[model samples]
Target: MKIAIASGKGGTGKTTLATNLASYLSEEKQIILADLDVEEPNSGLFIRAEKIFQEDRYKMIPGWVENDCTYCGICQEVCNFNAIINLGTHILVYPELCHSCYACSELCPTAALPMQKQKMGVLKHYKKGNIDFVESRLDIGQEQAVPRIAQTLDYINSISDNKEIILLDSPPGTSCPVIEATKDADKVILVTEPTPFGLHDLGLAVETMQKMNKDFTVVLNRFGVGNADVEDYCKKNNIRIIAMIPDSRQVAELYSRGELVYDKVDSFKQSLDSIKHYILGK
Candidate 1:
């Protein structure tokens, strides 16, 4: 099964759940954990694995080929992102603003704008025991994350089959990156805190998932710290609450030290067990 661990906002424990859950499950089965947060992949911090492979990932963007042409205004007109602009005598291409839609390049009557590969990120694969971990990080100054995220997902699909469980540590929020990360997932675990802000963002995430027609459930993190509003909201909406990871100083300490808590904390292990049970049962 392909499962994605996601959050509506940052610091809600998506990585905490993803990393630990994958490690715990790898003991009995082969697990593939992919960190799809290309902008800032931190799941690798907790996983100590041997580097299996690493490669540079590139995205296609329109390159302005001055010699090829005509300062036709068509390239600029077809670009919805304003990535290309024609200045009567010259055509400018902004690599950062380009969405790689290829409209400008394909629609250019004079073919002045040509599609070219641009380095956007790097992907690293690691292996330890029965766990295969993949992390893709967007290069600094790269403006778009969806391309990197889509490439990472493509890589994951290329290596994955129907037997192994693939777990995605998706980027936080309900934006394009998160959508790309979770689009193919069989199930999604939306981790959220019990605070008001957490509840609010979780609602947005839930709506996004519902609109996408995805199977998902909630895992409340920092369970004891905030009020019962989150619980009330989930219950009212009839969303399944799979697990509740407690608010504890021990978990905080272990997390701060970059250690996995499933091996150190009993409550944390139980929470992970609950998640595993729910996922496997499905």
Candidate 2:
């Protein structure tokens, strides 16, 4: 099963849940752990595996060829991302704003638009016994992460068979990045805290998932430290909160030290098993 552990906002313990599940599930299952939170991928920091391979990822952006006669704003008009800007005398193309749909280049009346491969991020591969680890890290100052996340998912899916479980650690927010990361996932684990902001963003994320027709549920983090407002919202929406991780200083310290909670506490592993059972409907 391909499962994406995602959150509506940041600091909701997605990396914590994803890394632990990947580590624990590897004991008996052949799994691929994909960290698609390219903007800030800290899951790799917690994976504790040797790096096997790495590659720089690139995306095609619109490049001016300077062969055109007409200064028409057709390119700018056709481009929805505003990557191509027409100043009447000179048309400027911003690579950062480019989504690389090739619409500006394809529909250019003067055919003066070319393509440039902009370095977006890096893709890394690693392995630890039975588990295969992959992560995408977006370069600083880059706005586009959806493409890199898609490539990461595609890479894992291409190599993995049906028996292998793909666990995706997604970026926070209900944007294109999260959707790209979890679009093809068989299931999605929405991680959230019990605070007001958490509940609000979780609702946005659920609506996004529902619109996409994806199977998803909540994994409540910071259970005791905050109110049960999140639980009430879930129950009202008919959303199932399968598991919860309490707000413990011990767990926090262990996380800060880059140690697995299950290795230090027995109950942590049981909690993971409970999550697994819920996913498998056992």
Candidate 3:
């Protein structure tokens, strides 16, 4: 089963649930924990594993070959992203705006535009006993995250078998990165706090998932700190909240110190157990 832990907004405990749940389950079975938040992956901070594999990830972008140029404006006209601009005598290409659709390159009359590899990110595979942790980090100043995220998912899916559980720690929000992260998940656990901000963003996330026709449930973090408005909304909307992690200073301190809290905190462990049960049952 591939379960994706995501959030509508940042700092809602998506990584907390992903790391702890993967750690707890890995004790008995093989688990693949993939941090799909390529922009800023932090699951590696909690998982201390031996590096087993590493590789640079690249994306295809058009590179102008002036030698073969015919001065035709087809390249510029075919580009929907405006990545290529024709200035009568010269052609300009913006790598950041290019979506790698290959339209411009394929349509060039003189083969002046050819697809070339551009470094977008790096992927590292780590192993600790039965758990396999895969992390992909985007290079600095990289504009598009969807490509990196898609590549990371492809890497994880390539290695994972049917029996092993795959946990995707997705990027925060309902944007393209988040969609790419959770597109193939068997189930998505949306983590959120009980505050008004959490409630609002969670609604947006829920709507996105619904529109995608996904099977998802809620995991309420910092359950005791905010009002019960989130609970009321979930109840009215018929959304299943699988777990509620209590608001605890000890948990926060441990998190701040970059430590896992399930083994030390009974409540936290229980919450993880509940999520595990849900996954196993499904």
User: What's model 1's lDDT at 245?
Assistant: 90
Over the stretch 72-183, how does candidate 2's per-residue lDDT look in tens digits? 7789999888878888778898888888889988888778887778788999999998889998898999988888988888788777887888899999999898889888
lDDT comparing candidate 2 with the true structure: 0.87
Instruction: State every prediction's TM-score relative to the real structure.
Output: 0.97, 0.92, 0.98
Per-residue lDDT tens digits for candidate 3, residues 1-282, read 899999998999988889989899999989999999888899999998999999999989989888898878999888889999998778899999999999999999888898999998899999998899999999999989999889888998899887999999999999899889988999999999999999999999999899888899999999998899999999999999999999999999999888999999999999998899999985
Model 3: residues >4 Å from true position, as ranges? Answer: none
**Best first by TM-score, ranked:** 3, 1, 2
lDDT of 3 at 139: 94
Instruction: Show where candidate 1 strays beyond 4 Å.
Output: none
Collision pairs in model 3: none
Q: Give each model's whole-structure lDDT.
A: 0.91, 0.87, 0.93
| lDDT over C-alpha atoms for residue 251 of model 3 | 94
Which of the predicted structures, 1 or 2, would earn the higher TM-score when compared with the native? 1
Q: Which pairs of residues collide in candidate 2?
A: none
